[model samples]
Every structure is written in C-alpha cells, then in structure tokens.
Target: MWRCKMVDLLIRILPVSAWKDRLIQWHVPGCAACSEKLAAREEAMSVLVQERELVSVKDFWPVVNRRLRSGVEREAPPSRPAWQWVSVAAGLAVVILTSLWLNRAPFEEASADLTQKLQIDYIRIGDEPARAYVFQPKGVNMTLVWIEKDGEGE
Candidate 1:
C-alpha cells in the first residue's frame, strides 16, 4: 500500500477521540512523512480553533442590526488612499513591462520552434473566424488546445 494510505488506515483504525495522540505515539516515530503531515494538521487545527474562538454571532449581530436600521452601506471609508492605488498600479505596470521585455526574445524563439514542430489546422463549422492555440507545459506529458470563435457581437 501507499505510505499515505497506510497512514490513513492507521488513523482510521485507531481510537476516535485520542487518534492524534495514538497516531503520534505509534506511527509517526517511524515515518517522517506522516510525522510532518501530522504536525501540519495539528498546526492547522490549532489555528482553526483559535479563529473559531475569535468569532461569535453575538459580537456582530448588534452592529448588523444597527446598520440594517440606519441603512448605512459601510461602517468606515476605504483604508487605502488613491495615491497608494496609483502607485501600486504604476509598480505593477513596471514589473509587467520589465518581465515582458526580458522574456520577449526567448518567447519569440520558442514560438517559432513550436510552430515549426507542430502543424495545426483549423476546422470551419460555420462562417465565423476560429482561433486555435496549442501549448504543452514543461514537464507535462499532455498538450492542451483551446478553440474559440472570434468577432461575436462586439
């Protein structure tokens, strides 16, 4: 059986309430993968429990009721200023332009190699112009194709 399957089986076959303690004591000492997974699960469960304790219906129901009566859409204005958004947009644009400029030659060479290696023919089902894109991701065994009709009610 797979290691994960064995770990799952051990967890399921053990006691219900004390499964974590039993699994840690019995199984995790021998299996490093299971021990790491168990630690991550424990951390996630502790964080979930802490977040659950922080939330209560009584804490927000009064504010919601008051807002419903007062018809206020928001309690506070937007936290970010307009200049911050503009600067963020400017930074994003710069990053995008820099990346595209750096990768332009490599992308063009790859596209030329791909077109030379693969021949794609479009099928016309009707009078619409069709677009077909074929791509194979690195380290993947599958090629994906996307076909779409263009110029529709624009």
Candidate 2:
C-alpha cells in the first residue's frame, strides 16, 4: 500500500529527467496495483488543479484583511473591562481582611493566655523548694517521706 502511494507521489513530483522516473516506470509495468493507484491519483490531482481558482496577487491582501476582520467580529469579546477586574480584586481583598479581623481577637487572647501560663509555671518551679526534696534515697529504695520543717512546704 505504501509503495503504491510512494510511487504515485514520485511520479507527480519528480521531473522527466530524474532517474527515479525510469525506475518507477519499470516498476509500474510489473505491478498492476501500483499502476492503477497512480492513474487514480493523477486523475484526482488533475481535476483539483483545473477546478482551483487562481487569485490575483493584487486582490489577495484585500481578501485576507476582510476575512481577518470578519473572524475577529465572530470571536468572543477580547478581555474583561478594567473596572470589572478592579472590582473582583477589591472583593477578594475585602473577604480576606474581614476573615482576618474576625479571627484576630481569639488569636491574641490565646497567645496571651499561653504566655501567662508559661510564666506561672516557670515561677512555681523556681521558687518552690519542697517540690524538689519530696524524693529521698533510703538504702537502695526510693521513698517519699515528707519531714515538715517550719516555714517549709507552706
């Protein structure tokens, strides 16, 4: 199938002086299918060439410009208006700001409460001495014997 198409293409494109023309002519006589395909392709090409309208070079630019303008008119409107773009941006900004403003107070309160708790824990751990001596070593066994001294564990 491909050989027939290739031979048809070479016969159409190659000049008379090309050696491939003689080769194709030799092959076409032996191959009945290739000869038939080449005949059909040549007939189709001749009909197409004869039916095609030849445009003058002077009239070509006007036709091209008219078609281009018509195509532009048929297409959708180019870009959105500038004001529409600005309004969309403003809307997105307002939504983002409102969400941040609504959440600001709780976030601040949580941060302050965490700071206070951490400070209180630090103070209690540093100032309390009885919390440290609750564990005592007694002959290879650990014991929690609290001996109360005055002003201690108060």
Candidate 3:
C-alpha cells in the first residue's frame, strides 16, 4: 500500500523522462491505483488546455488599436477655466505692484523732528548765511557737527 501511494505521488510529480524509467513502467502496469492516477492527471491537463482561450493574430491588432485610441483620448489635455486665467493675471499684477512699491522711496517730512532733538543756531560768516548744529550725546567723546550751506528755507 505504501509503495502504491509513493508511485501515485511520483506519477503526479515526475517528468516524462522519469516516467519512462524501467522501474516506474514496471510498477505502473501492475498497480491499478497508479494507473488511475496517471489517467486522471492526463484528463485534467487535457480539459484545462481545451478550456483555455487563445488569442488569434487576426483579432489582436483591432483590440490593440481600440485600446490605444481610448488611452490617447483619455490623455488629451483639458481646457483652462476663465477664472483660472483671471486669478493668474491678478497674481502677476500683485507681484509687479509689490515690487514697484518696495523699490520706491517713502514720502514724508524730512526735518520734522530734527529741530527739536538738536539745538539750531544761525550765523553769517563773511557773507554766507549758514546753519550749524552740534550733536553730542552725554558721556560720549564723538561730537557730530552739521553745517548747512546757504540756508534758504530749512
């Protein structure tokens, strides 16, 4: 019984060359179980081959062409919306305006608070009206003297 089971397993797994071995041939002829196993394996293989669908060369190109056309249509570029274009234009305008505003000098009174911080004195030297001021902070050795030439309105 053990030998019959082993022969059945070998018949299921062994290649054609192994099946043609003299020992397998002698065992398979007398053993009804192994012969039935071999017949069943052959029948199952035949049924599977018959049931499998094979693609013909004549129908292959038309199926491939249809798939390729569908893929190309799916990959076609979409149109942009009006709001998208408007938003892009608005963003570009904002960037340009911000850059221009950042580069421009600020408009403010020049000497609005300088007169209160520093002591102003006017003196005429030899015919020229000049304004002079000394900026010396407490406990500092550096003294800054600012003299304006031809003081007209400042």
Candidate 4:
C-alpha cells in the first residue's frame, strides 16, 4: 500500500513476489488502482505457477539449445560488393543533376510566355509590381499573382 510513483512502477515491472501482500496493506484505500492491479496480478501468477509445476526445466534447456544451434547457417555469403553500391549511388546522382539541368528550358519558356501575355490592354495594372509577378494565361483575361520577398518568392 505504499504507492509512490517510483515504488509502484517498480512493483508493476518486476516479477510477482511474496512481498505483494505487504504492498497491498501498505497502499490500502490511498492507492486502490495499484492494489487491485497487484491482486489480479498475484492471481494470474499463482495460476501460471501451477501450470509450470507440470513442466520440467531440467529436461528443457538441452532440446532448446540444440534447436537454436541447428537453425544457424554456416555457409551464408557476403551480401553485396562495396564497389557496386558506390557505382549505383554515383549513377543516381548524375541522372538527377542531368534531369534538373535539362528541365530549365521548359521552365524559362513558360516564364517568358507568362510575361508576354501579361501586357494585354485593360488587363488591370500590367506592370511588374515590386515584390510580385503576374502569370497571365493564353487567350484568357485571368492572371495569377505571386508575391516575392527580398531573396525568396512564394
């Protein structure tokens, strides 16, 4: 029944023991949750002990150790060559850089197209406003505005 957080947590994490009854009295109504949990825990442990009484640990370890040793493979080869992994990483980096460089043309063309279409008459304030860019659509009167700051644009 003594139920400080550190002490109660220690009881819950440990194996059940004869000292549990003393714990119940020590905590009492001040710690009902801990007491009930410990009682249920004790009951479960008693049942488990009874079941284990029918087992022979003296006759168990050799069979278990034999099974564990037998399952180990003695002939496994190394997984992969280091040079192969290095070449794969290098090739991936090159491909990414090449793709990024090649896509710049399309992006630049789209920006130019957007700039030219923005000069239409009555299109409302067609000048490139400071901190802003206007992307006007083809054959349409609509435009999208993006506000850009000192060194960043969003």
Please tell me which predicted candidate would have the highest lDDT against the true structure: 1
- TM-scores for all candidates? 0.27, 0.25, 0.23, 0.31
Worst lDDT 10-window in candidate 2: 117-126
**Candidate 1 lDDT, 52-135, residue by residue in tens:** 576564578788899888877656665678779989999999999999999887876777676557767764538766777787
**Which number leads on TM-score?**
4
**lDDT (10s digit) by residue, model 2, range 1-154:** 7877787787677777566768676778889886664557667777784534656436577888898878965766646686799889999999999999999878766765654453211223335532223443433223353433336545
Off by over 4 Å in 4: 1-37, 47-82, 111-154
**How many clashes (backbone N, Cα, C below 3 Å) per candidate?**
0, 0, 0, 5
Global CA lDDT computed for model 2: 0.64
* Best of the two (1, 4) by lDDT: 1
Tens digits of per-residue lDDT, candidate 3, 1-154, equal: 8998776577677778655485587797788776765657667777784434655436588888898878965665545686788889999999999987775543212232343365555666667987787776554434588766665566
Q: Which pairs clash in the backbone of model 1?
A: none
Q: Once model 2 is optimally superposed onto the true structure by TM-score, how far is the C-alpha of residue 111 displaced, in angstroms? A: 0.9
Top-down lDDT ranking: 1, 3, 4, 2
Each candidate's lDDT (Cα)? 0.72, 0.64, 0.68, 0.65
* Regions more than 4 Å wrong, model 1: 1-80, 120-154
Distance from true location, Cα of 144 in model 4, Å? 9.7
> Residue by residue across 1-154, what tens digits does model 4's lDDT show?
3446756676577566756556645765567665555557667787675755766556777987887799764665655786788889999999999998999778767876766666533322335334556676675535687654434443
Comparing 2 with 3 on lDDT, the higher-scoring candidate is 3
Choose 1 or 3, whichever is better by lDDT.
1
Q: Which of candidates 3 and 4 is the stronger one according to TM-score?
A: 4
Summing lDDT over every window of 10 consecutive residues in candidate 3, give the lowest-scoring window. Answer: 106-115
